[model samples]
Target: MRRQGIAPLPFAQGLALLDAVLARPAGNFVPARLDLREAQHAADAGEEVPALFRALVRRNTRPARARTSVTSAPTGLRDRLLAAPAEERIELVTQLVLREVAAVLGLDSADSLAPDQVLKHLGLDSLMAVELRRGLSAATELSLPATLAFDYPTPEEIAKLILTRLDLPTTPEATPASAASDAPGDATDSEALLGWALERLSADQLRRSGLLDRLVELARESAPAPEGTATVPAPAEPAGTLDDERSVDDINAELNALLEASGFDLD
Candidate 1:
């Protein structure tokens, strides 16, 4: 009898070949119709083959794209904050910080007293103060002094302390050299600085508005600050501008009066 050419292996043996082929890296092999037919045949014979192929297909699929960064939107919180005038920025920060405090105290929904009143007369303790600070810092990325919680306990007082520590433009006299630098390429730098300031102010406002807790929770699920040096203070507005009025002492007195009016029961 004439010797028969070694015909392709039977269906089971062909499936073994297919498995061996698939075992190699994806880049190394391109499957042929013959190989696919053999696999199908084997799968039809075996109970587990369909599940195996389905799993592989699912594993190899790509995920859908996620939402873009909120910072890029024209009317986003960041943009709105950046666009605000200097005085408005301070007011915004104060409101945000109080909102955060209210949220944390589980008072977000309840129509309780104003946040400042809660801080003053509702018996806020030292531990709660630190908790507030931690929450605010995490949301706004500004390091507030712990003593501020005691020294400027009310929401309004805390807002002033934050603006001061951030070296915000409280008056025209304190405007920095950077604010006056008008080099050809200064606009971009100025915008970036302004954006950073806006971010801090927004955080402060969130804290004041009883929204800090929500912000903190949201931050945990998102990208964090990149590793590097701490953020520097934003350049102050030009001295001659409306922000140029008043001295540091004046700002301090204002803060003190607010704290006193809030009935902070400090020693």
Candidate 2:
């Protein structure tokens, strides 16, 4: 585009430019597809695109910084795991591992995985293994090896490793479930058995397990307001007055104020 005399947009400004254009009703009519060469010409010479670029430039001078770390999981997960009783700790870790594995495999439910099925048999490759390890590391705040799936082979085995790495208490007597025969069938069957076991647990144990927090999150996700029913459109910007229109130099004085109003933060 620069070779064609088009100004290169800084990443943040480019995003702001997109938002500014999309705010207009005419923006919805923008073409869904365009020849690459023609798109470059349109960006370079189009009146609307240039005007929006000016507005975005007048809004911010600094570019946004890139993120420096992985997105973190919900706070206090490790602490919660530590506080839970031995049996419930095992259950929580098992559930967490199952969910992560299902997500990697694009399965609809975590229970779709069997506790004893080898990960390779379930189609987990090296890259998927690394992705799963990254997710588990973030969620559990533990340093998991890159070859996690190959070593553990199953969700149940991975869960046990995570618990061991976290140094979570699991005395054999305290965790009778560890000694019991593996539940017959898939993770769903095991979950059903777990449900029966939970009925015998105290409310305090359930709370410390973080099961209630998980349930609340699931409930909130499942009960979203109907789409379009609660949709709210952005209010239209008022016409600029003589004072509102300013030269480039004067605009810099109002840059932060304008970007704040438009919901962009360059810093």
How many residue pairs clash per model? 28, 0
> Against the correct fold, how does model 2 do in TM-score?
0.37
Residue 197's lDDT in candidate 2:
55
Strongest candidate by TM-score: 2
Global CA lDDT computed for model 1: 0.53
List the candidates' TM-scores in order.
Answer: 0.35, 0.37
- Per-residue lDDT tens digits for candidate 2, residues 111-149, read 777777899998898877887997899898889987889
Off by over 4 Å in 1: 1-66, 74-80, 110-120, 169-267
Candidate number achieving the greatest lDDT relative to the actual structure:
2
Clashes of 2: 0
lDDT string for model 1 (1-267, tens) is 001112345688678768988888765754332224433444444423444244332221344467687675555333445556676866777777777667656575425545466474665667667777877786666877786567776777777666666654334533467654533345667545644543444433444565544434444454533454122222255657663354545444433333233333223
